[model samples]
Target: MRKTSVLIRSIFTETLELINISDVVSKSIRCDGSELIVCGRRYDLREIKHFVIVAAGKAATPMHDAVVAELERSPHVWMNVTALLISPTAPRHERANVTFFPGAHPTPNEVSREAAESTLSYLSKVDGHTFVMFLMSGGASSMLEAPIDPNISISETAEFYGALVASGLSITEMNVLRKHFSLVKGGRLAVAASRAAAQCTLIVSDVPSHSSDSVGSGPSLPDSSTVQDSISLFEGLQDRVLLPESVISFFNGPLLTETPKQTDKAFARSFHRVILSSTELAEAATRLAKASGFHVEVDSTCDEWECRDAVKYLLDRTEALARIHPRVCLISVGEVLVQVHGRSGKGGRNQHFVLSCAMELRQRHSHITVLSAGSDGIDGNSPAAGAIADWTTFERARLMGIDAQSCLDTFDSFLVFKELGDAIMTGPTGNNLRDIRILMSDHEEHAIYHEF
Candidate 1:
């Protein structure tokens, strides 16, 4: 048990190290003395009079710092640069050319509005000689947002976001709804800076592949979602998800606005690259596991599935794979769904997911271990990133007077994982690539708890 524990944790940590923000940025973007290149697309500095850098999301500060650091290498780029950075937390750096604003995540605050206003204002006045770059990532939908309507307050906006988080909808669905609700999202940012000579957006995706439009609600990219789509999504979730009254009325009312389409003029000047995502994460983890002598299988098709269904499906896959190999490592990328009920307990989706597996692991009587965690180093409202569970988890909880089923039912898995010393902790990683679930199985059909 201890050997498998160390192996999985080491693989997880090494996988994270492979996705360093500065390293990824340095490789994807470069600036020569007279020109800049992003993902092989070059822009001549001689034709541009200004550079506008607008960075927003959980990874905003790091992205801003990396880009600004790169720009500084070019001759006189800082003097002609204007940047507005909105971070999920307080600003990590203070620069004279960059206006830093701290915003809230999982919910928007008044500060988010301030940040959004300043960004739009800065973007609204760019001319053809100005080049704009947007650093977008997860959390931007809430961390950098403004309502299309003047009557919507920050608190009400926050209430709506809270409802969305609890709705258990896929990130794609939630972001589609966000596009219609905000002034800056859904290609509005691109529209604001449409007069600029060219615009480039670099994204660290936290959604499924080819869904970069969902990242930060695609503020700098063209949006295909419409008001009708949002209306339908809200209708589907309305029975169990109690959205704010104002939000519901706005979505249903005639005043709601439609998002930009593919043919929007703003997209003509814009191009985007997904700099980092779960694909990179999966590749790194798979390499490490394969090197460790385990036959690895990766399944990402179950993304956005309900927590129980995802767990069951993956466990069955793990067992089947273990049958043909001496050892098996089953890697699943992307996040699972967990619909919150009213005011639930103190666990996030990752920890809750691991606890659910504990119940099944208990009955399997095999040497199977599971680790489910967020790549951002946060799992819901809990202090830990996620949790680890194995077949011995249930036996240990019983010996410690802990009720595993109660913990899972009440959404209080954090407490049990903490007591069992199985919670995965990494603080805030400042990077978002969605979530990763690693299952390690050694097909030894030993007896249930008697060996311990």
Candidate 2:
């Protein structure tokens, strides 16, 4: 058990190191005096009279710092450099030229509105000689916002988001709905930066497919979704979630506008690159597992699966793999959905996943250890990032007189794991790339080795 725990920790640490915001940004973007090179594109910085950085998301501060460091390395091209950063947390740097706005996440608030207005205000000042650099990541949809209609209050927006969260829809579906209602999402930011000489967007993708337009609702990239798609998605909720009347009306009203598309002139000078993705994290974990003398099997992206089905599928595969290989590690990446019915309790999808697996593992008396976590180090509303479970997790719950199924049904896996000391906590990891699930099994492992 100790060796297995150490191996899991090593894999997790290695994955985080590979997706470090500072390292990703520094490696993907560089400014060399006259030319600014990012993901293979080159822009002559010498001709630009002004260079502005607009960044928002979980890793906004670190990403901004990396860009600033690269810019400072080329002092000749550092003239007129300014920045506007929006994040769920406070600024990490105290740069006079960089304005920081701390916004709400998982849901938008007045601060989110303020940040959106501030960003637009800065973009409004850009001229033909300005070069704009946009940095975006997972939480941007909630951290930055500018609604197209004035009648839609922040509370209405919050209610809309709440509905989406409870709708059991994928992130892509929710983001598609989000892009239609905002003024600065779905390529609107690119439209706002149209006056700039050139624009570039660097993305740290949290979406399953690393869709450039879906990350942060694709503020600086073309949106392929339409108003009809958003309406259909909301309608498919089938009364499982409730939306504010204003929100319902907005979707039904004539005020709905399609987001900027590929044909828009705003993209003429815009270049987008997804610098980091969840697949990279999965690959990093695979490498670590192989180095530890375990046979690694990576599952395809499981973005569309519900929490229950995803856990079942991975566990079934792990069991089969363990029979053939003495040591096996199965990795799966992507966000899973959890349908919250009635009064749902505290716990995110990852915790729910781990709890569900624990139930099955205990029933089968399997000697497998599973760890599920959000790469961003935050799982839902709980303080814990996620949870770890083994064959004995259910036994521990039974001994404590805790009903595991009851917890799973009520969406209260957080409490179950907390009581068992199986919760994985790593305060906000400054980066987001979706979630990762690691399942390990050893053919000769016994009951004694299953105890954490």
TM-score of each: 0.96, 0.96
What are the lDDT figures for the candidates, one per model? Answer: 0.87, 0.85
In candidate 1 the C-alpha lDDT for residue 113 amounts to 93
Clashing pairs in 2: none
Clash number for candidate 1: 0
- Model 2 Cα shift for residue 302 (angstroms): 2.6
RMSD of each: 1.7, 1.8
**Residue by residue across 382-431, what tens digits does model 2's lDDT show?**
88888888877877888999988899999899999889878888889898
| Superposition TM-score, candidate 2 onto the true structure | 0.96
For model 2, what is the C-alpha lDDT against the true structure?
0.85
Put down candidate 1 lDDT per residue, 332-365, tens digits, no spaces: 9999999988667789999988888888877776
- Number of the top candidate by lDDT? 1
Error of 2 at 49 (Å): 0.5
Residue 425 shift from truth in candidate 2, angstroms: 0.4
